[model samples]
Target: MRVTTFAAFRHRNYRLFFVGQLISMMGTWMQQTAIGWLIYQLTGSKLLLGTVQAIGGLPTFFLSTVGGAVADRFPKRAVLVLTQSVMMLAAFALGVLVSTGQIRVWQVAALTAMRGAVMAFDMPVRQAFVVDMVGRDDLMDAVGLNSSLVSGARIVGPAVAGLVMGRFGTAPCFYANAASFLAVIGGLVAMRLTPSPRMVSPESVLRHAVGGFVEVRRNPRVLGLMAILLTVGIFGWSYSVLLPVFARDVLGIAEQRYGLLLAANGVGALLGSLVIASLGDYPHWERLVTGGVFLFGVCLVLFSWTTRFHLALLFLALAGLGMISFHSTANTVIQTSVPDAVRGRVMGVWAMVFVGTHPLGSLLAGILAEHFGASLTVSMSASICVLVAVGVSLARKKGNGALRPNVTGSAGTAGQES
Candidate 1:
């Protein structure tokens, strides 16, 4: 069972948190799909859609470190509760405005910024808490499982989101997202991890936050890892953002078919996650990140060129595999390398790069698509990814390339502890 990753379920806190988060993630994906459609409908400009998404994503890069500091120094449960509440309120407001026919492009941008601010705080704390629930030994399994759920929700949620948006309206999508936050809050309250001594009396917030940055820079391995992961974020993982374009332009599909396009990628990601979880340990970090990310870039480029929808779908799955491989491995490395004191802050930076940097790719792709074409823009993005991967790979050194997998029994340890 321990080898199976079901071992993490023996812990009461993780069990509840995982189940609740699974529901909330599904709703969040549903809302995300709806937002893109709603914004596209209202503005009728690809640039504006790009702008709206850029607004939502930009704040995470700025505020995540502060959020991480709070996570490391305070009770993660309290931090999560506060952030989730803020998110719920923002969702409710969006629903109300859209429902009343008063919503504008600016309003969507503003509200999305609000939610993004909340998420900046939420991501690090949530990631940091994984160790608390399962310990370092199980971190890989937990991370894999966590990643799996996100992919699972992506697979199922979009299909449901498209249907709801098509049948009902966008308001319900917003409301559902707001309601999902409660599930996360409930799980946080049920957790049972003890805070460290350093975590208490956290007065020097600035100093503590800076510490994480200093530490990451000081560690050659981690700095290299960040560089590798940055490529993955900026290029490899833009599939979800590009999905709407693929559905409308390349495949010439409607709502359900659009949903299936995402479904194929999600299914692939889910399978990737399950593979990582069953590995029972982290693989060679450098090789996995670089190779996986390289494959993603290659697949995206290949998929962009294909006219056949079925063939594109196959390539998308390959892209998903590479994307998840990059994600799962990078996560394992970062969590393992950092000390507990600054773990949250380090993971915050990870979230910033892995997710926050995506807006740049999205915005660039949108602009290029508007000027040239969607296919060319996607191809350009893939080209950049290839360059990044090759450049980073050549510069990378050994030992830092593929550290041994650490699978100690304790969940409290970082994956690097092996």
Candidate 2:
């Protein structure tokens, strides 16, 4: 039977989740664009830009494992509702502060940290919840579609935010984001889901969290993927922290045009996600993962060197494409390979390496940008990413059999548990 690119949409629960999340994520990207612009406008400091982004990642770096443990012990939907509500409140608070002209850097940093703490829980549960919604047969398609949803938001959110910010100021962007949460919260409440079996254990939460690490250690392919994510997370992903600097200083663009630059990246990412969704059943996962990363790194390098606005946008779009391609494939592979019992915990580790490492990368990027300038800093980081991708590809060719999908861990029965 031929699988459709939109197979996941056939499931009612996933459809609701997708539509709701699409709305919420657009709000999220709007807030993100506003925050970055706000910080840059206030401080005019590249290091602070990186520092603020790093502040947000610190909580996720430290607490995502514990959050994963919570996911295993409780219902994911309830947890999501709670996290979404908290995030809504945070956005509301930010909106109030900005609207009142009382917003300060410290306040923004604190709220960013708050949201990050909530994400530490939300991300792992949400990722593991995909299989619960669509079952194993459509897991890969679901993952790809989710990526497309996020990328789609990235496309619309920033463009809309730019127009709003240009006309009304950043406060409205925050308010709009605050209101967007209602769609997702409502969807979560409306879903008809079976109760996820709680992993009752005599172990402490720390021990349960550690179990995820143990599982990754036992699986070589998962371990290798984690390592690759670490490199990409730290060096490759951190490049975004410099986008504001790049836009204003290098590309000589204004606030509105900067949003367009981000939208360009989103367009590429959206296309990439659609490609992945269409090829959900493809066998050669390794090639897609490595090739995507190499393409991203190369485009990022070229992007950093470009002074022309259109040229920079072109490179940014290609980089975005490569990024989503690598991320969506790797995520699907890892989720499908792990046992359902430990999926949340394993995803916690994934969050730790992927999301947690962002701060370190941001700090590094900020420092380098402060000293060497944004263009050179980005070029250097992109070079490291390119080199890492090449190294991983070479190692795989040298008989690293563990990188292939494991038959024993196949999603058939392993994904169906509770």
Candidate 3:
């Protein structure tokens, strides 16, 4: 519940990057909200909405590994700059199209696909670059604190987008998002993070990409973590994409109210992330992730059954708390578990699962909502998530001591007795 995790800010580069990232995140959220609202208005089809989300994830699913390769081969700073520029352009393009009345469902989906492709490279580089600013020792604190700012954006972006889109339509929101990129770009340009050498090397790019997969394949704990995250991403995270429908159709809420509802989730998420930031390293973080995932599913099931808006909001707060706690912990574990050299690729692989599957979930949920109902989609996804959590627990029990993983080549591998 602490507002700022300033202890991690002792590192000069981290402090600088944090401020810029905070600003950039707000714009990212703004664009996302505006895009969703626009898509809903234009197509009025939940299936298209789902397809837009699915298209955006295309790059993450396909290019993320190569994006990691790109992060590995090039200077992360340069890569970030390029990706951020691409994002800015894409946002601007969407805004122009909407403003000019040239936008259509296919256009939105195509643009979203372009942005997702850009994100495939952008996310892994950014996630990997955090360690460069803060180092591994304080990496968990840095990651936790970073989530606070992102959730903060979740707090502000939607509300702002809702108002802006209401007053000026979605175009201004898109323009604002495009313009927000300059903040991160400026922050990255100003940073003097020293370039570090690669931990693992191969003669060719394909070989290097394959090498990262091989290294990860050797580690069962990382696999376990990835599996858990995959479950959370596919199920626990689909609610947001479905929210517009809930706001418009189910909840009988207005445009700005959608933003307020999201802000409520952000409030819970921010609180949870700050709590993690305030903590020391959690040895039991694995169980925390698992428990959060399970709690998220439980909350979602109940939330789906609700007809009262205020009651649904209360359940959403609980779901948000579980979601952020799970995400912050999973990110910390992955960053800490992987070695530095292949960390970006490993993180990219993680993003591939965490972000890549979101579209599929959203698409299915939207289709279900269109045909069946939101409640059923929410309930079904949550039920599947519970099953996924159980499977994850069983996998962990089987792997413990039998096949531990240690990327650090240090003592006390995961699943081993200390």
Candidate 4:
């Protein structure tokens, strides 16, 4: 049997979507990098940074399930277009505020919250939209490529942000992000997506939303995976929220150098995504998830302790590699294992755990950084992730088959991807 990395690209619609994502994600990263730096530079309050970040994510936590329900009920392309348009306007507004010297921390936080709310709906719909584009035969490969696209953007966005912020100002990054959305909108408009099979319920929206929870309850594998994602998303992946602190106070680096640190992480993440793509539907996704989680935690631990800038870069890169591998495998497993009727709902739950947990982690990290210092706060968080991995591994050893997905779904299965 042979496995192909670019299998999903056989579909023209997916190809267009992928290209659009490649452009938009870079701009998103640019805005993220600029915003973090701008906040830290203005206030130098770790807790405030965390607070703003948390505020943004709060909507995703509560509304993602509803967003999933909307995806299941409506056309994903339309949902995506609406969400993306709103996000673009938000980004442009932020840029205007910053450029006019009218931007306040409260304003930034408010806009961030608005963006997060839009993402709450957009993420699940976009995630479900992938299946509509390529079906199940190439899901894993497409997922890998998608991860690669994100990391590839990470590599470019931060670099550009650093340069632009260092020379002109943070406003430019925001403006660039706003303009980038046009590309995504164009791609979406150009797509000729076949209508996906819809899940209909003659019940209240609340009842329909609750059904997503019930689906996860019935699947032990998905339950365990979501638990893992929550742990990692909060304690593990939130290390990024602290990177600005790490670069400024700890490593004593300039904004450009800080961007380099981010780019280095992207370099490793890109490699990780490519490696997953090359694996070509490997069977033991559990091992990949566990190993990646453990490695990510360990790398963060090392990164926090390391005083040298170069060494810290290496650790961050390794952390990125581990993070992407863990997430991509987990995403593919969830998408392929669940029934088509509930795929959007489950993905919404997945997005909730994956992204919604970040606010709590950011808040915790910010508070800890203020009291204990950024280095120690990050170190403690990483340690918690390591413990979570160990606990889950031990629990699974005792006869729970939750580590592996069953791969029985209406659209297709993970096993079929191979």
Residues 282-304, candidate 4, lDDT per residue (tens digit)?
Answer: 76777788888888899999999
Error of 1 at 334 (Å): 0.7
- Expressed as tens digits, the lDDT of each residue in 311-400 for candidate 2 is 988998999999999999889878878887888999999999999999999999999999999988989999998999899888888965
Could you tell which candidate, 2 or 4, scores higher by lDDT? 2
The lDDT of model 1 is 0.76
- C-alpha displacement of 270 in model 1, angstroms? 0.2
Runs of candidate 1 exceeding 4 Å displacement: 1-4, 193-203, 391-418
- Evaluated against the true structure, the overall lDDT of model 3 is 0.77
User: Best TM-score goes to which candidate?
Assistant: 2
Best by lDDT, which number? Answer: 2
How much does each candidate deviate from the true structure in C-alpha RMSD?
3.3, 1.8, 4.8, 2.7
- Check candidate 3 and list the clashing pairs: none
Query: What's the residue-level lDDT of 142 in candidate 2?
Result: 87
User: lDDT at 409 for candidate 2?
Assistant: 53
Question: Compared with the true structure, what per-residue lDDT tens digits does model 1 show for residues 278-355?
Answer: 776434456667777788888888888787888887888777877887788778777877776778989888878777
Better of 2 and 3 by lDDT: 2
Candidate 2 residue spans exceeding 4 A from truth? 1-3, 406-418
lDDT of each: 0.76, 0.88, 0.77, 0.86
